[model samples]
Target: MTLSQDISDIAIIGTGPAGLLAGYETNPSLNDSQVDIFTKSSKIGHPEHCSGLISFEGLQRLNVSMPDLKKKIGYNSIRYAKLIAPNNLSFRIDRGTKAMIVLDRPKLDGYFAAKTRKRGCNLHLKCKIHKIGYTKGYWFLLMTNQGKKSVTKSKFLINAEGIHTHLAKSLQLPVPNHKWHFPAFQAVIDGVKDLERDCSELYFGQEFAPGFFGWVIPLNEESARVGVAVGSWTGNNTRKYFYKFLKSHPRLKNRLRKDKIVKTYGGIVPGAGPISRTYHTNYMVIGDAAGQTKATTGGGVNIGGFCGRIAGKYSKKIISNEISSKQGCVDYQKQWRAFFEPNLSLMKFFRRTLSFLPDKDWNKIFQIASTTGLEKNMKVTDIDLHGTGLLNYAFQPKVITKGLKLTPHLLLSYLRGVLPD
Candidate 1:
């Protein structure tokens, strides 16, 4: 390939699932004429970091929703979640059907990339965007790969780069508010003991994963993804903390045979809700770069996928002259915000309150949940995408009473932010 200093219609940076889908959604007229997608990595998805636990609804929304992998990558369709406390008090929420699935993320991304490529979008892998600037109605990007440097131009830029916001920040784009950065450490273990492939588990305690928590998502009857995340308020000692957690828990210690560990993954997740402004000039930011993640669980795939489509659609409108590019960017942000902000606010409220709690508070909370049948009231379809729905339980006297008993202060915090009475 040779360099051509031509103006591209749109340039999508990053080849994560969101970026790949964004390129795919770019109208045929716009993309076939002029669109380019770039990724710094040699492959679509690698050094995979997610637990790969996504809701059925989320998968459908992503257009990647499938019952299972084509290559039989192995997955456990989850129907239950066992929330465990420090003292080992646990409560199970069972949906009894396939509400979510644990998957191989790398393969999932590859599937989307293949589909996007079929749509005729130009993909540049192993290309890194080092800097970006705007002038004369075009965005100029300084890119490099294998000691080779080149500059590219685009009328519009869709930054779907996962959690890294360097491009946006360098371009002087607005960023999400910062209070805590959740860094995770994970281990893919096989030959586990006493673990159910269909039942995922969440462990909570400040010492284990301050601010966030730890999780176990089984991919099969014998293997699962296990990880822990700690908030930015704590230092960047995620690996140290994860090892401590693995050693401290009786169940984890026994189940994770020293020789059974298969792999490890590490990554950072931004939490505090999405940024206020995701559009600046001819720019539209989606995915983690826009912080379109659920604060409760710090996952972004579904929400990001949903918003990426909106961005792609409007980008086409801009190219077709149906709308101005600036307005298209504005509408893109507006569309995603209308549906996600309120839910994100709710999740953020709970996250902030929970982040401050000590280990003992979690024990008390779990104790209340066990006694109140809260677990029974929960539907298996509880998706992290809408944290606001969790508050619906307030309508139930038993649930509310039990919640209040566990932490009146947390309830008060909720009211102050959401109810204000």
Candidate 2:
């Protein structure tokens, strides 16, 4: 069990939930000193970009509790979402369960870091790995720490570096397509009118957020997080698109007051499903780096956290010599896929179908959904498993009959859209 100072059993790049969870999951198998989590940021959770809407079920599966999060850092409960079509038509989806909550994201990361550290994982903040190489079954990471350069070696590597896939690309892993990566922007603002504390709203339109959508996630009665994500192919500035959405959207503009900004955050979101390969002989990729995000919602925390836990559990096997590193990596890949691929793949298909539909088609679809009780039948049992819920709703005899009756063209368009997938 003895080792050199510069060497570790595992080196995790990035201190996000994925990396922290990966470290935490190692547990009794690997001592804390054997795992090192490196981050470019100086703190555990800084520069938060997520809207922080996550399912209590998902968080529970990851061993995170609402009470723990609330007692440490506050969060808000949400049970409904309003989906607005391009033509201003909308429908309300009631999630009839105690499943969703809005997290104080920065603190959430801090919580994960605290847990990981308590489990004996080493956290090396402000240490950015600039270059990485594999040689003789060990990964060498060239890093800069507080302006000084050094190298560290590890038997295994976990990439949790979020959306910038530079490290994954360097390892020759197929990164998510650039076209499907949307630039997203959001702001915390006060003085909001008619804020629904328990409801979040999604606005869909090309003029505002092409190939994606805008969202209003209410934090409280007086303030909310408003944001927009736009596709790269639109040739539009995401900030400009956000400004336009803030100032001109028919329903949203009326709800905001001028100069009421509290804070703003922006980042690129991956809409593609999980990458083609997430593992190799001595390394694995998790989190946004591996595109472990929901294409439908651009949410990665829960999905990536699941994958990270798999990687963490597999790490114990690899480190304890219970399994070869290569087999462990392969198993990690297979396990995560088994846990989330069906839903992620289905969500990707839905995203593609929605992207192909025109605004007029959206209007008709909304009309049909309203008239045929499609929205009413959408009893989403779990927010993270939306694909399954949607499938259950789509196959209803009444929904099928009404779709064929009212919007056969829309149905045909959907069939055509399936061909591309």
Candidate 3:
């Protein structure tokens, strides 16, 4: 059908997991209206930007299944890690047998999109919705594809568009004060030299990635995804910092110097936190577009997907006339924030506190980790998408005692973020 011919009860912009899940659960096929999804990319998971690491536990929480474990889905598993400090102090962390895993992100997203389509949602890829307006209780959308313009309408809208949400502003909803982003660059390398095949590494120091941290995630013994995130206060040019990180770090240079760069991509991720408000008249926002990423790690797939499911369920209720669109919108924010806010707040604090520390402090932190057997805890536990796992670090007398001596303000900053606003 022509684009102009499209009409729906719910329209979703962007095809990320958040939008796909939202469309999947909110399919309006039962009624005269439909749950229609539109994406700017032609491929299922192209224009790849996100770091593709999801904990196995995260998969179960998303209610999705991987058809293959060692074959098609994830080819590598992480059980050992080297947490290197600025002073070359390192802490070894192993998740016993398997700590974390890497996903073929593009394939994963494509898999879900196909499943969502089969679930009865009309997913239009390479489809861009440029303009939106509300009139007579309907959202009029101006969509374009290959220079062709088509008009469509929907009673409700789901905004899963990635960072720098254009719709939230175009719709003139109450926007957030500012969007803090982690300027990051990632590349695929043929070999991650000198590092353990199953061990991932985190390099800490302002010199490495001023605001955030640097990482090496192994795809296999011969390949890995290497990247770094620079905080807003430090600078926005991650490429420059990435170069600095490569040349200065001992292991990174050894691994990357002789390796071929398979591919490289860069993007911005929501760093400050979720937007202040994520609801409007007949609209709801989810995913990176709404700052639904984990504050500590900048990963959003699982958390955003979980919230997207909530959005989908609520949209269905709104379509069924069981709740008003406005009510559904409010509930979307409340429910998502209820489950994530407290954790999110603590994470935001943790990230900020990390930024506040210097290389010496990082050295102290890892020193404690190595001596205190913190790595033992990680090797056996599952991935904590929300950063709750780090809480165990604070309970140690020696760790807390050293932390206070090194960075006394850390506690104050933690309190500021944790105390309800």
Candidate 4:
């Protein structure tokens, strides 16, 4: 059918996990034309920018079945992590069981897109929605593909465009804060060495990844995704930083067979928690567009996709007149933020505070953490809601008493971070 032939009940942009899940949840009565999803990318998960690491609990919250996903998308299990400091001092956090999943992101997206289609949502890849408007009681969209323009209309809209917020801005919605955004780069490589199959490594220091850190997430014993993200304050040379890290880091360089680099990609990470507002009249935003990414780790699939599910379910209600547009917008905002926002806000506070410290300070912090057992206590036990875990460990009466006696200054910093507005 032509774009102008029928008016959809709901329109979604971008086919990332968020958009696809939104369409799936909408499930407009087996009528494929009632819900339309659009994206400029030719494929559902092409040019993957996300790390694709999510907690098992996160997947459950998004209504994803691991057994089903394993058979379809395939994934790597990560049960531990090695955190390296600037001075090469390091510590390990062992969860003793699979704590994270490294997904084949493209395949995950493809799986969801296919499922969404089966649920009666129309998927229009290579079709970019360039403009949108709300008139009277309907939403109008202008799009183009292969140099041909098309127009469509819907009762509501969902924007899941990731870091591209131009459309959100055009709609007069509040975008994520730019101050916390960072440029990130990564390379998939084989011939890796001296790395455990179930462990991910994080390297911290200013010499290589200034204002941020480098990571090696092993897909297996001989291959991994090596990447780095630098704060916006570090200037725009993430790729340069990445290459230098690959070549210079003492332990990391020795672990990777750099010559076998299979592919390189990069994207911007929005770490500024959620924007002030995620909804407006007849429309809502989810995924990276709404800044639903984890502040400490920049992973978005879990939270973003979860929020997209909420959007999808609510969009269906709004379209069917089960709820007024205004009430639907309010419900969507409250429902998503109620469960995820507090932890996300805490992580953002911790990250922003850590970003200001110098390399020497990081080394000192690591040293103190090791000696005082802080590292063991701060281990991230809950991947989906890790801030609560970290906070519980740090704020325990015994831990606080020890911190006050052993390192009053560091304790003050920790206190300030938690209480920051």
Error of 1 at 410 (Å): 3.3
> Clash totals for all models, in order?
1, 1, 4, 0
Q: What is the lDDT of candidate 1?
A: 0.79
The best candidate by lDDT is 2
lDDT of each: 0.79, 0.83, 0.76, 0.82
**By lDDT, highest first, what's the ranking?**
2, 4, 1, 3
- Model 4 TM-score relative to the real fold: 0.92
| Top TM-score prediction, candidate number | 2
Tens digit of lDDT per residue, candidate 3, span 344-419?
A: 6666667767765667777777777787778766655445444555666667687677667766656554453344
Q: Tens-digit lDDT track for model 4 on 1-421?
A: 2468888888899899899999999997643338989999997799788777778778888777877777988889988878899999998887657678888889889988888988888899888888888899888888887678988888788999888788898887898877678899999989988878898888887788765688999888889999999888778789889988888888877777668999999988777778878898889999999988888878889899999999998888887778998999999999998978688878777676676556777787677567666656655456777777767776767656545644544445445444534
In model 3, how many backbone clashes occur? Answer: 4
Can you write out model 1's per-residue Cα lDDT over 283-364, one digit (the tens) per residue? 8899888888887788777788778888888887887788987788888877888867678777777777787677777888
- The CA lDDT at 79 in model 1 is 89
**Segments in model 4 whose C-alpha atoms lie over 4 Å from true places:** 1-3, 30-33, 372-380, 397-421
lDDT of 3 at 364: 77
Report lDDT (Cα) of residue 248, candidate 2: 93
The list of candidate 1 runs beyond 4 A from truth reads 1-3, 29-31, 65-74, 380-382, 403-421
Q: Candidate 2 on 139-250: residue-level lDDT in tens?
A: 9888888888888999889989888888888877877766678899899989999999998899986777887899999898889999999877666598999889999999
